[model samples]
Target: MGPSRIIAVRHGESEANLAYRRAGERPLVYGRGDDEVTLTALGREQAAALGRLLAALPAGEEPEQVWCSPYRRALDTWEGARAAWGAGPLPLTVDDRLRDQEQGAFARLNPAAVRERFPGEPARREAEGAYAFRPPGGESLADVVVRLRAFVRHLERRADGRRVLIVAHDSVVLGLRHVIAGAPDAELAAVLEFAPVLNASVSVWRTGEGAFELVRFNDVGHLTS
Candidate 1:
């Protein structure tokens, strides 16, 4: 069986994201609706930069699968990068499963306030990584992994020896990296020590034998002038 590669790219910044406010609530506004957000000026530029990188890849190596979070930001990222891969008129597949893990009652709150109000919850989430803590009415990090794993498994089976691109949020992106790296539950503790991935940065992974391994981690060289 041929090895399959996946390029996981985080979406450009969103207003809530930049503000460190919650995002999973209030409905996703960028990708699916007629009444949604347009990219911020900086976000547009980031998308263009990501597009150029996609354009520079080898011929026939263009991404064959384009999956994105249902969020508007992720949708716009994929849309902006579409032409770079000669994918005009290609529909971007929206995956709710790829949405950021829900923030629960904290969805629209300031991060600091959430910490202060739900002190213990934040501590648990921080200590456990995305898997151990669940916000009220939201999911735990373990919940996210299950959905992400299903998506990854589906992609592996459908790769048909082609590259895949996914545009999503920071939590999802980071969680994927950990999952693919084969880090156990005990290892989530140290995973966040690495430099944070920037907007539009890309990561690469290959899957085999029910496992995934990292080929590249947070490559943003293309974003530099």
Candidate 2:
């Protein structure tokens, strides 16, 4: 039987998020590689708190199987929260496809720096926009949807009665919305114009008679508590 409930949780805030906050969208002189980045002190707390919340979820929502990004931050969030939640021996699988959108040439840089260093890129981005124009050497949002399409199918095939948790980065989490629920680009962009998926936030979906439906998006009430 395939899994019935699907949950996607963004990894807790990282040094990367802190760096972006400190720099305010400007390039940081230093930043960790995706695999090297770790959760901040608060991030660790958030992850643990998330675990406790999960432990207290209604039986229907508790995770039965887990998959996480191979990146350090995502891996740590899943392990820390699960251990803290007191859930015993749930199976976890690390999937590289769950990794964050690869940063490539801008791996550790921000938007302004990309413009200053590669003046042409800004114009290219303005012309092609977020959905199409990939950062140099990086994957586009469209590219992410392609792979996520395959991954979602893989999930449906194995989900029978399982409540699965996906611990991953923001892009991976958002990409799943498009693949799993067919969120329209305009709808997603409009929502993103006002809000971002916070660290350790949870989004949920479940199979229906016809297709998967979004149960919630970016639910972070657990973190506030």
Candidate 3:
């Protein structure tokens, strides 16, 4: 049996997110690696909001276990949420597999920079589509799916019948959707193009008769309310 419920949350907005937003067409370079980027002030507030929302859940629906990415932003977000929850500690594990999709040489480069740097990558990415396009030395969405599949199997083995919470990146959320729904490449690509996941958003899945069903996707009502 799998987990009775799975709640996945994307990390709060990070310095990188803000940098990219403000960079416009210029090449935005990070002084630190992606894993080291911390959340912005607003991101911390968003995380605290998530914590409060979780604390308000019915007793039966509360999370039993927590899995989080090891990245700094994710760790900080979890810390912020946990502090706001003010509840007894839940078992928390930092898993490298939950880390964001690796962008390789294209890590912080905008499309224009990527085009200027690699020259051929844009055309190649376009040709391969979102699912199959592996950045210079990075993993493709398909690669992310491979690792996430392993993680899901691990969850089934370790967290059966429990409520589990996962704090991870947008790519991990997307990968989980693909893995759980058994979605095709085209469908996943469509989602990538049309429905980008938001910072600190919550997605939920429930299991019944050994099948996982999506209850919500990219829900940020908690942040607004």
* Candidate number achieving the greatest lDDT relative to the actual structure: 3
Ranking by lDDT: 3, 2, 1
Between prediction 1 and prediction 3, the one with superior TM-score is 3
List residue ranges in candidate 2 displaced over 4 A. Answer: 183-195
TM-score of each: 0.80, 0.91, 0.95
What lDDT is reached at residue 93 by model 3?
A: 88
Q: Model 3, stretches more than 4 Å misplaced? A: 184-190
Tens digits of lDDT, candidate 3, 5-105: 99999999998888888877886665778899999999999999999999999988989999999999999999999999998889998988999999999
* 1-225 per-residue lDDT for model 2 (tens digits): 457888899999898788878888666645567798999998899899889988889877798899888999999998889878988898888888898887678777777677777888878878976667688899987777778777877877776678899999888877887767576655544333424678999898887886777888999998887
TM-score top scorer? 3
In model 3, what lDDT does residue 85 have? Answer: 96
lDDT of 1 by residue, 111-161 (tens): 566765677876777775654778888777667877887877676566657
For model 1, the stretches where C-alpha displacement exceeds 4 angstroms are 1-3, 21-38, 83-86, 123-131, 206-213
